[model samples]
Structure formats: structure tokens, C-alpha cells
Target: MRMLKRFFLIPIVVLVVSCGGPELPEEVALEYEALPKTLDFNQHVKPILSDKCYLCHGPDAGNIKGGLQLHSAEAAYSELSENPGNLAIVPGKLEKSEMFHRIITTDPNLIMPSPDSHLSLTNKEKAMLVKWIEDGAEYKDHWAFIKPEKHKVPKIKNEDLVANPIDNFVLAQLEPLDLKLSEKADKETLLRRASIDLTGLQPTLEQIEEFVNDESPNAFEKQVDRMLASEKYGEQRTLDWMDLARYADTHGYSVDRYRDTSPWRDWVIKSFNENMPYDQFIL
Candidate 1:
């Protein structure tokens, strides 16, 4: 009856664990159904741990359960105190990794995010953890904590099409796919594009006719100037900064209520319309 009862336990936990959750094989023999891409510890694994496991096993010293802190590489990779010879994570060895077994186990008392903790790993998450540990369980510093650095602009073969620094990045992407910029847009199409880009409105019929009739080499430049001169330009441009500027017309937090913030909003639009110097606008 004991042997039959053991066989009825959750599908994966029984096979993953030992006779009484003590003995473990030395070989790295666990299999993954599929690993879609090369897993990165910081990007893929850290997010899962943060959302599900971190509540109990995270960096918070006061709430740490099981006396485990999995917020870093050094601690998780160390030997477990409770189980002298065992480790929570054994790089490239899932068979010997206790964390792997805890996450996979279905036993009410043994599984992590415990039965009453009301947290569980999805099948895909479980697989990702398995793949991560089997691949050596590498960890890295969170991206936010790292200092930022400027990268050299990537060069592309088609220098003729490159109009700005941004185009260099665009063409660099296209070069890999054996692609190039679409043929130069006709004057009418170009004017419409510039009108929409600068003022968020299509070129008026009068504007289209003016652009088509003017054969001057600087006709497109003049149209751009005209669009930038429009008040609509400020309205269109300020939209992108609305969220960045945190432009809300209310007292946010505990008690939300209407507030008169239109003056600042108008100032942003007015600055754009006045063609304020970049530094002055930022200041």
C-alpha cells in the first residue's frame, strides 16, 4: 500500500524527489520539453523569482522563510545550512539542486511558495527554472543598477540614404535583412508626410497644390518650415511629453481631486510654439 500510495503522488514531484526526499542522483539527467531561446538569468529567471519566489526567498531579511535568501548568486549557490551536503542551486546539475526540486515538487509541505502561501509557478516558469539551473544558473546584476554608457553609432553600407544619426541605426537594421530605404517619395506624398509629422494633420489641398507647383529645390524645406510655424506643431509635439512630464490635472494619491494645472500645460505648448532653446525648455 505504501508503494502504491507513493505512485499516486503528483506526476513530477515523485520522480524528481528521492525515496523520502533525501537521496539524489549525481548525474544531470532531467529533461526539458523545449527551451525556446537561450535563457538569461537576469532577464528571464530574475523576473520569475521576483514575482513568485521573492516574497518569501527574496532579499528581505525579516520575512525570509526557510532561512534562504535567493536574491543573489553567492547565497543561492552556497550549501544549504539545514541540509549540510545539499545546495539550493547546483550550477549545471538539476539532479543535485534543491531549489529545482522544491519548485518542481507537488508535496504540500515541500513545494515552494508553499500550499498555503497562495503562489505557484506556471508550467512554463517551472520549465524555465529547470532550463536555467541545468544551464549553470548564472546570475547578473540588475540592469537598473548598472551605469549607462553611450555606444558608437552602427555604420551601414548605404551612406547616401543616411540623413541623420537616427537613420544610421535604421539602416544598420535593414542591412542585415538585405533591405534598403523605399524609393524617394514624390513631392505631394512628401509634403503630406511632413505636414502629418510636424502638425499631426494632413496637408490641406492648398498646401498640396503649393508644394506641387513650386519647382524650387528647397520646396520641401519651406513646407517643413511652414508646418513648424503652426500652433498645431506645439500641440502635436506636447502630446509625446504629456506622460513624461506627468501632466495630470488632479491631486494624485490618497485623495484624488481636480486641480488647476492648465497654466503649466499651456506653458509647455507656448514654449514649443516660441521655438524655445532646448536648454531653456528643459530648464
Candidate 2:
């Protein structure tokens, strides 16, 4: 009887051990082979400005903000470079580019798009603009530029030391700068980082304790999956949609009447939970 029980327990132990195996680190590899060393203005910058900013500053509109017109490539170059007050863009210099400065400025007086316009370019867009100016604001035709070709992954001295491919890409860039990557975070730090990233809120003491005690290899991934499946994910997504739509519960005009838009809010949340494609939402 004792032998039979031990034999049965061996399989149970193996199963538990297998389930608790340590998970491999997530892949951090860069998909792109290369990033553009220089930015072209006419190709990249013109198209972006035309779609987002031309409505206000384009030709046929007399109200050119700060006497600037970004409608035509020539107009944009002339207005930006010819600074009578020494306030225009000096190609290859960001600090000298008043156009770039105004876009990034938080002060209402210096900020672009003004109060009347609700649109604002994202940080990524602003960064691209700054890079373009830094790259001498070179204007070139679009579609003529070819996409970068895939090259062999560059060799690093301590390739064995790298836990994932992302490290390789990062180290490759850092190598040129003579910089080193930071050390791997501690277990506590890793857990906290994962928890906060997976769920917006910090983990509770009990939850933290449970995760720390869990010996399963895929424990962190399991926690991530669980959090993503929770109702809070839907709620947070709903809040994101609300921000994008600029939805408010009250009308802004004189009467300032309270509006019952909670139903619509709930509808957005439901759509997100159902994994509705963004194109369908627009339709």
C-alpha cells in the first residue's frame, strides 16, 4: 500500500514541478533592421503637417497663426528660415528653431494651435519635427526613398551575456555611444514592475505575497493574463476612449446642464471588451 501511494505521488510531484518551471524572459527584439539616420522634410514633414495643421495655416485662410503658413513646401521653408525677429527656424539647430520651440512650449502664449483649435500633435510627431530640423531640414521627394534592407545581426563581445535579442539591439546602439546597459532588476523590483504594467494600480500586500510565493515558471505571465481578463481593463479602456472623444458628463455652455452620457460610456466599454476593431468604431 505504501509503495503504491509513493508511486502515485511521484507523478503528482512531477506535474507540480513542471507547472512551476521558471518562465523565459519576454522577447525584446527590435523588428526593424535599421532606423533612418536622417529625416527628409518634404517627404515626411510636409505630409504630416498637411494632414494635421494645414486646415488652419494653409493658403486661402487669412488667419495664419504667428504669420506662419505651412501649406506649401516653399512657404514653409521661407517662413521658418527667414526670421526678421531672429525667431525663425535655423536648419540643423533645434534651439534656434522658433517653430520647433513654439510647438513644444507649454505656455499658452507660446504654444501653437491656439485655444480655438482643439488639436495638438503627439509627442512622437513633435520629436520627428525636431529631428527633421536637426537634420538640416532637408526637403526631398517621397516614394523615391527606399526602405532599409535587413542586415546580419551585429556581433557583440558578450553575446552570451544577453538574455534576449532586445539587449542585442540596445547594446548595438549603446556601443557607438560607449554606454552600458543597466543590470537586471531584482526579483522584488521585477514583480512590482510587472504588476504595475499589467494593472494600473500597485499590487496589494496580499497579492504581492501570493505572487512571491508562487513557484510556477509562468507565474508572472499568468498574472498578466488574469489582470487583462479583469473588468478593470475594460473600465480603463473606456476611460481612454472618453479622453480621445473628449466626452464630459456636463454641457459646457451657459446653462451648464448635467448630461447623462453614462450609457454611451458603458457602450464604449462593452465594445472594447468585445475586441471591436478601431475601423468598425469609425464606421
Candidate 3:
């Protein structure tokens, strides 16, 4: 009789929980499935928070709303003592979390970004936030502030084929998916690729013949060194920076007049050829 009674109660409990009650009850946990797994804090959740919440809740001390700060990992998890809510984030508990509640609530006064502030979260963003909260609300350092870490090269079966540590890492990723790197380009094709990349121009027929005929083991490296020595390489590299510096043949005005910016332009081209350190180049 007790066994039958417990069996009968399972459906009722599941029904109550599913219709927005509490966390999944352990009894029906196996049967009930969550929505598709999409709870990455960095990739999915961060962009939504940055766009919607950061303006009012972010690092700018002068404009923080409700004494909440969501910019840093520390602040997001902090308690909203001054505000009406208690905890801003109660990890692994979405229903009890105030941030999650404010976003999901239909009440105009309770919704986040506030209707008066003209900011709102889409259904998809709200779902992501819910899942993030349920997944322990893990936080990562802001991407700009994160320091780069050196990764150990992955060991792969085709050790002989690996050209460098970079190739080993790339091949390791591809190995799981049954893919491999394509074959090396022929000499003529390689020459053309290098020329265009370094000088912004295709290799001449004479240059192509010279590369194709070179039988030395260091032939490709020699060709690369030669291209780097060319004036065109410097000229091609500095085009973007020149544009950013607003270098032009003439002053950009209605009464346009020629400008003497050649000295600055020449300095850029010279800096590239000399392999100037980035800090010194900027200085």
C-alpha cells in the first residue's frame, strides 16, 4: 500500500515542479529533462549581460544603479543589502536568485534594466541566464584583462608530419573529427602566396622560375627573407596605420590643399623595414 501511494505521488510532484515551483525533485529527476545545454558564461551569457546590465550595474561608480555591480566576478555574487533583494546571485538555485527573478518577472516595476531605462532582455537571454544560475553561475576574468597562458603542445599519432608546436595543436584538434592538414603547396604556388602576402603583388614570372628552380632545403625560407628585405613589404604593411593616422595627399577640406605628410609616411615604411619594436614604433 505504501509503495503504490509513493508511485501515485510522483506524477503530482513532477507536475507541480515543472509548472515553476522549485528545483527538480530527485524522484522524477531522471524522467524530466532540462532544455538544451547552453550555459557558457563567457560565450553566451557575458555578451547579454554586457549589453543589457553593464551600463547601470557595471564598474562606473558614478552611475551604478541600486548599489549593484555586475562587471566583476566578485561584485556579481555580492549581496544586494541596500536594494530590496537579498542575494544578487544564488548559484545553483535559479528560483531563489534575485537577479534571475527580476529578469523573468512580468511585473513592470520588478523587471531588470527597468522599462523606464528602455533596456530589456529577450526570451533567449533570460533562458541562458536561468541555466547559468542553475550551473553554479561560474565567472571568468574579463577577456581584455585576462593574461595569455602558454599551452603545452598536444602529442598526436602522426608525429613525423608535425612541422611545429602550432601544427601539433591544430592536428590534435582535427584528429578527433577524422581530419588532417592539407599537403604543402608547390614551390611556384608558395612563392606567389608569399609575394602577395608580403608585397601586395603577385610574383613576376622570373621570380616564380627562380623559386621553382631553387633545390636547396632552405629555398622557401630564403624567398621569405628576400621578400622581407623588399621596400614593397614595408609599404604594404604600413597602409592600415597610415589610414588610422589620417595621412592624405591633401588636407581633407572644402579648400583642399596639399599636405607635407611624406616625412611621417616615410618614417612608417622605414620602421617596418628596420623591424622596429612596437613600443618604439608608436613612440
> In lDDT terms, which candidate is top?
1
List TM-score per model, in order.
0.50, 0.48, 0.56
Per-residue lDDT over 1-283 for candidate 2, one digit per residue giving the tens place of the 0 to 100 score: 4532221222222112223231111220121113256556765688767766777667755666445576654666664322334434567765555566566555564455554677776665666666676677765544434455576776777786587676788788787778888887765677678666645567778767877788898877777777778766677777867888878867845676877778888888778777776658656
Better of 1 and 2 by TM-score: 1
- lDDT by residue (tens digit), candidate 3, 170-217: 888788779988899988888898899999899999889988898998
What is the TM-score (0 to 1) of candidate 3? 0.56
Ranking by TM-score: 3, 1, 2
Q: Which 10-residue window of candidate 2 scores lowest in summed lDDT? A: 24-33
- Name the regions of candidate 1 deviating beyond 4 angstroms: 1-13, 16-31, 81-84, 144-250, 255-283
| Alpha-carbon runs more than 4 Å astray in model 3 | 1-150, 242-271, 279-283
Worst 10 residues of 3 by lDDT: 6-15
Clashing pairs in 2: 20-216, 20-217, 21-217
Model 1, position 44: C-alpha lDDT score: 83
